[model samples]
Target: MNCADMLNNLDSSIDTLHTRTKLSEVILKKGISKKDELIEYLRAELSEAFDCRVGFWLQGSRKSHTLIKPVDKNSSYDIDVGVYLFFDAEDEGLSASEIKSTLKYALASYCEINDEPTLQDSKNACEGLKYSAFLTIDTPIYYIAHDNATPMLATDSGWVDSDPKAIQKWLTDAQDTDDKRALMKRIVRYLKAWINVKWNGTEHKKIPSLAINILVARHLKQFEREDDSFIHSTLSICEELEGFFKVENPLNGQDILTLTYEAEVFAHEKLTELKAACLEANDASELQKCLIFSRLFEHYFPQIELSAFNRISGLPVTVTVPELTINHYDKDDKHIRTLNINEVTVKKGESLTFSITNKAHFNQYCSAHWTVRNIGSQANDANDIGHKVVSSITESHQRGAAYTGSHTIECMIFNGATVVGANCIKVTVKPAFPVLRRKKIFKGFRR
Candidate 1:
């Protein structure tokens, strides 16, 4: 049931912006230099004209370390930069719209001289500068009164009481207080990757990354392995979202998941399906676990090769291990034809037999020790791992597919405990499709 190695491989596979640290050391060095220049220009222009002190800070995923690259290569990466204008007693009367307009004008001037990036009126909160086809920086305007007041964000209607830094602090503090290995950040990245694969286009309404960040932070837990931690956290959140699915902002206590009823229902259904898939994967063997995760995360998750798990470990390191190929047989003792070794599948409630062929000839007196390793929750609960070793000359092992899981069997040919040949085969047992029966109801009515 433990797929720790595969999970670790997946953790490293995701191409998040944080994973671009090495690349950022080069490319983002220029990006940051441009950002600094733009900031200096804005501060000089705004302070000279409006006669107010200006401050700036990074917010959103870039600051939280949960930023993921766009699933579509053509899409731009968004950087949220919070701009705070500290107004003196004289400039306190500036309206929210006026404050936003002043910021836009300054940004427009910078863009005009730069000649590389263009400006757009990203209504409501921020003014966006499309630095390049692949990148954008959003400047959300805010103001503080000299009398000491909370920061207010400029919106279409009016100024709103908010602080972008507070939200980031909440996430940072929560993560800092918890797992030191940054498991929370890893989980958030995984969920964001899932979101990108499931709903990244205009075809579907997107779930706010803020909501996911908050929900995951609230329900986060640490386990000995990342896979177990992820599954438990997902299940915890999905279970809590049973009645009214709402994710509140940790800093302000406001429902951040503001989605339409239909969209909300759709999201809940998808998350529920994800929870079920996680459970199913927990009950699967190593290879099956990889398949389940691959499907869950689409092309973003790695596809595992059978050769990775085709290792034999019984012989000594100095000894030259021999090779063997496995053959399958049905309950009728009939040869089950299979083109590949690991592609064997059987329906539950059926019995299958396995035999090995020693490609490297061993002594005739060599004993064939067959070992059956049953995996999955069902098998664990049954407490019947089939660890019972059978010694036979033919190297035949028979087992019933009583439980649905990915199970394996191994044959080691040993001459007085010194192994000569070894082989293992993975078998997937799945539930058989139910057969429906047609019954006669009324004369012409079908039930």
Candidate 2:
């Protein structure tokens, strides 16, 4: 591929990597539902405890949909939820510690009632609820001024001016008139993913997401090519920061980076690394560019197949196995020919066998690994779909006798971690027949 075509393909791959799939969307929806439930519980409890109304709102990257999934599966993703107390601090004689303590008490009660683990008080700003090893919800207590609706976060020092709503609005407004806003957001996600990869399993101080957002929004410029735009915008931000590193809160123009000197240094170092990588990628040959990108992005960037790259570079491709086919079998050991439409139907509790065969030239070797996944259903229990590996074929059975639903079954053939070929078949499962008691009649004595 030419430079433009290669860069275009890389951009497309980045977009695919960043786009949230339907399953992921469903998972996030479930997470938000739980967050909403907890928020409601806390609101009621705090209202009862303080004898006043309490309001809540969402903030941060989760609210903006710019959150990047962590490279490591065990890494934590946070959703920020703000609880606003609708009473004057002066009237209640409430201090920041008091507010934090009250909110912690309410959350503790909530955890007890729901049979969940107790929330941890960070004591810096927010209380954390660990939903899973990979997910957390950070609830920050805020007090609303009686005279106005100004929001203030309860910190150890005192009430600090915090306007998450205004900041979120500013971010939204920054992209309002820009035609390349979508691409801008995608680039931001890419940058965040890069950060995650760069800082994985390290104790190094990382750049705050808000600070990154602020820098990108302030310095990002549009270009005809996405690669050029990403490179130029990133370099611009880095170079600008060399003089002085400061990111202001969009709402009040207060410097948010003043207290984060270590993070600023970290950002500079990472950006410098990125600059070097971009330079290398720009100077490398077409086939080498792919390798450069793969190194820069690690596993997140899809690697170009060696065969394809060899072909492009005028080298003889050695792979003889060029075609893969999937065959399905029924319960009676009968081969069921898959139609061109690629759809399958089975009764509940029936087992289906799938085999992948490779068409190869003489004296060529081929190997394959199989993976099956349910695409649309919420109940993704492993026990519901049991699979056993027998030789090269995989036999998967739907064990749920009463289950009736349509779910997409995706069968993939992998050459190591890279997907070589794949097939998706929509499986419609019919409900099992209800058992009925037969009326018994004696042969000689009729009823």
The candidate maximizing TM-score is: 2
Report, for every candidate in turn, its global Cα lDDT versus the true structure: 0.66, 0.60
Q: lDDT of model 2 at residue 148?
A: 67
What lDDT score goes with residue 257 in model 2?
A: 61
In model 1, what lDDT does residue 360 have?
Answer: 40
Estimate candidate 2's alpha-carbon lDDT, on a 0 to 1 scale.
0.60
lDDT digits (tens) for residues 1-34 of candidate 2: 3433433344532323344211255456666787
Q: Estimate each model's TM-score.
A: 0.62, 0.65
* Candidate 2 local Cα displacement, residue 303, angstroms: 3.5
Which parts of model 2 are misplaced by more than 4 Å? Answer: 1-15, 20-23, 116-118, 121-123, 176-178, 258-265, 282-287, 308-447
Residue 49 Cα positional deviation in candidate 2, in Å, after optimal superposition: 1.6
Worst 10 contiguous positions by lDDT, candidate 1: 15-24
Superposing every Cα of model 1 onto the true structure, what RMSD results?
21.8
lDDT of 1 by residue, 1-447 (tens): 335554554464433222421123333455567778888988899888777788899888777877664554355556778888887422567677877888888888998899878998657778879866446788898888754677888877778878777787777777655553377887787788677756655365667778878878888978887778888888887787776588877666778777888888778778878888888766676665664664555434432343433342333443333344444455555666533464478877667756555434666677776556555556533333344344655655667777788877655566784555555667788886657788967777576
Q: Model 1: runs farther than 4 Å from truth?
A: 9-24, 88-91, 175-181, 306-447
User: Could you tell me which residue pairs clash in candidate 2?
Assistant: none
Q: Could you list the CA RMSD of all candidates, in the order they appear? A: 21.8, 9.8
